[model samples]
Target: MSQQLILVLNCGSSSLKGAVLDNASGDVLLSCLGEKLGLPDAYITFKFNGEKNKVQLSSNPNHTGAVEALMEELKKHGFDSSIAAIGHRVVSGGETYSESILIDEAVIAGIEKCIPLAPLHNPANLLGIRAAQEIFKGLPNVAVFDTAFHQTMPEHAYMYAVPQELYKQHGLRRYGFHGTSYRYVADEAARFLGKDKNSLRMVIAHLGNGASISAIAEGVSKDTSMGLTPLEGLVMGTRSGDIDPAVFGFLADNAGLSVSEATDLLNKKSGLLGLSGLSSDCRAIEEGALEGHPGAKLALEVFVYRLAKYVGSMAVAAGGLDVLAFTGGIGENSDIIRSKVLDYVSFLGFTEDKEANTKARFGNAGVITTADSKAIAVVIPTNEELMIAQDTARLSGL
Candidate 1:
């Protein structure tokens, strides 16, 4: 008998990442990401049985087109019949969903209600769901929310200081992002230390294009950096992480910018991109900094400083950190970023082994801290696809 498989789909605004995982063993059999969707260079690169392959579409493919192309690719590999269910990564579940659930009409309605909150993500997520449902008829589908893990945060941590009516009427609060990544890495960090997740106080820093940090005590999220939307967290690649609310009014009055214009500026044109006046990528920024590019050097400094500050704050939220973890693109790959962050927080008795950190990139996991350090620092690669697949399998009983 063939092994059962779970298809996990994570759709961003412009990208769709799909993976086929063994439902019993949770090993990824195939993985792919269709990037540059709706553009001239829209193409897909997938791995089948550990072999990498690329498919460039002659015509620009939307979400539906992308899904159809992937299905065709899977049929070519002769594994299309092995799929048991589909799992989707929905960005915002609001206060409705605290765990992964089977997708149905009501669940689709619930996801649609969150489109106002996750303008860029939820629509694309819904597109993936609708397309998958259409193409894979009769298969069970599950929705795993990215904000679900952080729903454990207390009222004080999630509540904003704005008018109480705003939250009551509009559901305005700190609904953290990257919950799936944090949950995966936090568990991975606990396992790496040979400790139970429920016994450790951990600070998980998920640094990527959209960065956020969470304070977890006893495996439950206590507080997180992102609030309301992903736009309110630590400095991201293009999003302005945190700023005074008055900046909006100031920009309106001084620069003659409207609310939407200001929102676009902050969400699309700020952060390292704005500060460096160059690329938003940390690797490029780091390279530019080494070359004495003033803007790039300043951006790198600001990013490291903000990360260290947030990690220190998270430690307080965790009631004294037992472990510090780095995940996501920047966190897992950029050795310089990790070393700089550890140095800034060395006051907490966290010392990093430079050599160990250098080798922890590209799917490698390791302990990067000294033996005598007060807190353990780990570099754990996150696997949200595996998490989503597990949730799908358990919920579907596949």
Candidate 2:
């Protein structure tokens, strides 16, 4: 196969993650992350050919600076000239983009219009796009939306039970996040089952620092847990999953908090951190719980309960669940959490194989259900970067 390279950029609020992949094989040739982008001690880490290296910047680096540094590093490794196209992960496509498209001036503008919806993400995404454009002049660029895969959701599922005008005028409805991860894992799960994707009813739970669950029926997104933003989904590292809308007003009245403050609190200071009052990491909470810490125990219980509840809800949305697969950081690594949650969903006729469940970790994919279980449970690691690269290659005609 020809060694066509596809560069993927995933610019988050605080980090810029880039990977150079062999477009034909979807194999990552080089991967790097620019961390603490806006901080004084910003730095970058690169991994290539099984070797990891780090470089500390002398001063704070913005998105453009990060991209520039990454390009320079790739050039040193002689991978720059192999690049055929660049793929950017834009968080919101709103009502416009349902699939990856070649990034042009109009597409950039469309992404810009979504700034109000993904205020924290789109701008940062734009910064990366502009930076890559300058560095890789004339390279075909593509915008792969995080919300694109979920665009298949029916109106009843994405619509909020509010005034119609709110949705019509402000787009105030559920535009699920993590569509990229969900898309990759859904297809992978189908392949693992040796069945056609379009014939399966699957509920995928992507549990990570930021988490969301997706319900896919007939190879289309039927419903998802996330809403107008990622904060509306399952409990995350620091995010509160589901909450009463009235709590915002209540917090303002009694806690002297503004809407923005309340929003930040839920997105950054709640979840496992608030519940455990020890740490936001599941591993840390697991350790604390083992030590008989009540808060940590409660947090773990809450997280598992919420995950089980959403799995049940998604099964309902898909009419019935044939495959229940877990992916993402916690889902891939934490066997205990998966086992506990599966216990709650036993009514679905899923029986967990304790040994297999404990062994699936670090990108190792396997089935964790009893041979005769009615419902199949498996662990499939997600590869959003490969999905982005594939979309970029396809749309760019590489």
Candidate 3:
């Protein structure tokens, strides 16, 4: 049997990230990124066989141009014909899809119908799908949604406490994001603990520039942090998470800002950046906090407190926590943050192993809690691209 390779495409508003992975072994054969799309200095960088190369694209390049450039690079690397299918990281499937599936006419319509829910992401996802179809004709295309895993959330957990008509007519309810990362880490946490996923109650915190947490019971999502969009969760790099609805009116009255401007302020200028009045990067905040910067100290404190509170709530939602796992850019790398969070949640019977916590950074995965602790706390690195590639290969029968 020949090797099954999957081309995973993640299209964003201003860039494209593509990776070719071996389905059986989960090894990344090649990866490339096209940046500065729709700009005069658009270019692509490819990394393969431990070597990196950069290629320039036409001025103001679009998704089609990026795909064409990727194809040429693939052919040059002799990986074009080996690809079994293309997988796309779609942001929202709404209620139309519960899991990863092959892309078809009906699927396209469903994605299009959800454009209003994910205006910035769904359109770019569709562009990548269309471009892949045109460039890699006869190949199967799969959509792995960022919201699909959380579809298992009970209605009570997902529903907002709003007027029934608003929810019934406008679909105004919580639809969590970061489903792909949550799903991958949930299974990994189970495997790492030597327990069956269906028997484990896990709370995974995916902390990055964009962050969220999820409660998983028996391998299904029972609750998550993000709601309706990515902006309704824990404090992120710039996006304000979980603010009072009345803040809008307050801003309009005092700041003389319109609703759109207020919304932009919350989504683009708030969170760690707003609270610290410094950089959005967590490392910078940590450094400033260590230096006794009042703004950074306050930001760090609020971020930790909010995260611990959510973790406790999720544990309740899961009926009790057996495992508390951390992943993503911040979660996996920041030992200080992890220690602070663990200190806050010590009542949950987590005793931090300081040495182990410090050693678990830079791609190392291990339990960060003591053996005598009632619950296990671990750092499990997330691999969303591998999850997407596996789903695509399985759906395509590769």
Instruction: Show where candidate 2 strays beyond 4 Å.
Output: none
lDDT ranking, best first: 3, 2, 1
Per-model TM-score versus the true fold: 0.95, 0.97, 0.98
Local error of candidate 2 at 183, Å? 0.9
Off by over 4 Å in 1: 36-43, 49-60
Clash pairs of candidate 2?
none
| lDDT, candidate 1, 188-304, per-residue tens | 898889999998999999999889999999899999999988888799899989899899999999999999999999999999999999988989999999999999999999999
Q: Provide the lDDT at 142 for model 1.
A: 99
Across 87-184, the per-residue lDDT of candidate 3 in tens digits comes to 99999999888899999989999999989889999999999999999999999999999999999999999999999898888778899999999999
Using lDDT as the measure, the top candidate is 3
Error of 2 at 91 (Å): 0.6
Where does the lowest 10-residue lDDT sum fall in candidate 2?
56-65
- Position 63, candidate 2: lDDT: 75
lDDT for position 352 in model 3 = 99
Error of 2 at 54 (Å): 2.5
**How does candidate 2 score on lDDT?**
0.92
lDDT of each: 0.90, 0.92, 0.93
Residue-wise C-alpha lDDT for candidate 2, range 272-308, written one tens digit per residue:
9999999999999999999999999999999999999
